[model samples]
Target: MSTPWTPTEFEQRLRAAGNERYHHRHPFNVRMHDGLLSPEELRVWIANRFYYQRNIPAKDALIVAKLDTRELRRAWIRRIHDHDGHDGDEGGIERWLRLGEAAGLERSALESGEGVLAGVRLAVDGYVNFVRLATPLEAVASSLTEVFAPDLMERRTAAFEEHYGWIDREGLRYFQVRPPQGRRDSREALDLVRRWATTRADQDRVLAALDFKFDVLWSLLDVVEHACAQK
Candidate 1:
């Protein structure tokens, strides 16, 4: 029953959603990037985030499997490799583990995922299911969080290096490695979404999908902030 929309309008809406609700604006993220978080806080964040990191490759695989074109699949496969690595001692997952170790969390604790809050798991799973069921264009659009990631990464890296001396460059490898890859991956995905979303309805759906994805990211931070507040 809603009126139609233009692609520009859809893009504006997605940007507005990012401005309003993205984790970049979250106080936890601000405290984290600014190096104000205690060691315990960093450990909790690293542990909780392992759940999200583990699921990303699975979600990418699900999305890749849904693609009909080999070219698309080929591009999508990099995400899987980035997260899962060739032999498990490499890739983003391992880097995240190193981050956990740097934050003083045991390897067993991070891999166990026992510390993940219910809300965080639900938000991340919802994102995965949404991407799997949505159109490919919408799926790609949902990843527009990458558009904001590089800036966040830069700020976070500076904050850690300047304010938090507990972690050094080696300990922060996850943040160090992600921004460039995120920029490339996000640009490619955004281009694909923009090109394939030909109709107003499709464009609107893509924007909504991105908004939903932002909510997923925001919800993770919210859960963390709430847990911090409760303690």
Candidate 2:
């Protein structure tokens, strides 16, 4: 059997997996950051990405259900609240709809899934299903993508301001809000994995789960890029 790695070694490998494989480097995302996408292309991306955003709470709910401790569940419920918005606060989903509106998409169409591509739906739903079936550790590990997300959000916001000034400034609020939240949430999830994934096999499974998440994100962009290119 393979030997377990030290906590530091395991964390390093996890970070490397995200660094090398995350969708921030996907061709479509690179083009987005470089200001190469046309307005329609950007709208297509925004609309399709909404599908994934809408499902995040669903995915997190599945993971929360598998968490054994009351404390863990209490901590994890905040993710759902972030997207779904409890206590009269606006949630990320609403913020994203505002973004779609700022991009000149009709809010009605966005709410109705008007521009969501077939491939996008399948890929996003696949992610939710994977979490539904995954062990709590694997499900939580998959979310380690958030560990690197704050930087991506920062860069994306800068790119939008610098290149895509046509989009309204107000719609950029989601990006602004995510960085600190991503940092806090990612630290918690990573700590959980470090505590629970004590064996070599569990650590490897965690890596695999993280990779699966990367593929899901990359494939979403693949379909978006291909679909947009056809126009």
Candidate 3:
């Protein structure tokens, strides 16, 4: 049998996976952050990204269903609520809608998916289905993308403030709130993967799951670039 990796090494592999495949490296994102995209490109991106954002809770619910402990379920449940919102709090989805408006899209248009590319929807749906069908360990491991997400969020937020300043700052709340939340969520996910992925096979599975997540994220940007090309 191949020797199992030490926890630190296992995690290094995971981080490497993100470094190689994370959507932050996608060409479209690079262009946006570099302030090269036109207003129409930004608008299309905002609306299409909502398709991914809204599906997050549904995927999280599937993950929660696979948890063996009420403690685990309770902790994971926060993710769903964070996106869908709770009493007196407008959740990430609502903030995303506001971002749509700020980017010049109508709420009705975003909700209706009128501006979302079919490929973006397909990529987002594959992510949800992957989580739904995966073992809980694999599912949680896929979310380690969050480990890389905070940096991207900060860069994206800065890009918006500096380059896309026409967007209402208030609509940027989702990015503002995500850095800490992504840290917390990724910490939890990494700990869980460490505990559960004991064998070399298990670690490899986790790595593969994270790669799948990255592919999903990266493909969304691919379609965005393609869509803008046709416009």
Instruction: Tell me each candidate's RMSD, in Å, in order.
Output: 2.3, 0.8, 0.8
Question: What TM-score goes with each of the models?
Answer: 0.91, 0.98, 0.98
Candidate 3 per-residue lDDT, tens place, 1-231, comes to 888999999988888878888888888999999999999999989988999999999999999999999999999999999999999878999999998898888999888888788999899999998998999999998889999999999999999999988889988898998899899999999999999999999999999998888889889988989989998
> Across residues 97-193, which tens digit of lDDT does each residue of candidate 1 receive?
8888877788888888878999999998898899888877787788888888888888888888888787646878888889999989987877787
Please give the range of 10 consecutive residues that has the lowest summed lDDT in model 1: 1-10
**lDDT, candidates in the order shown:** 0.82, 0.94, 0.92
At residue 130, what lDDT does model 1 achieve?
A: 91
| Displacement of the residue 177 alpha carbon in candidate 3, Å | 0.9
Q: For candidate 2, give the lDDT of residue 34.
A: 95
Q: What's the CA error at residue 164 for candidate 3, in Å?
A: 1.1
Check candidate 3 and list the clashing pairs.
Answer: none
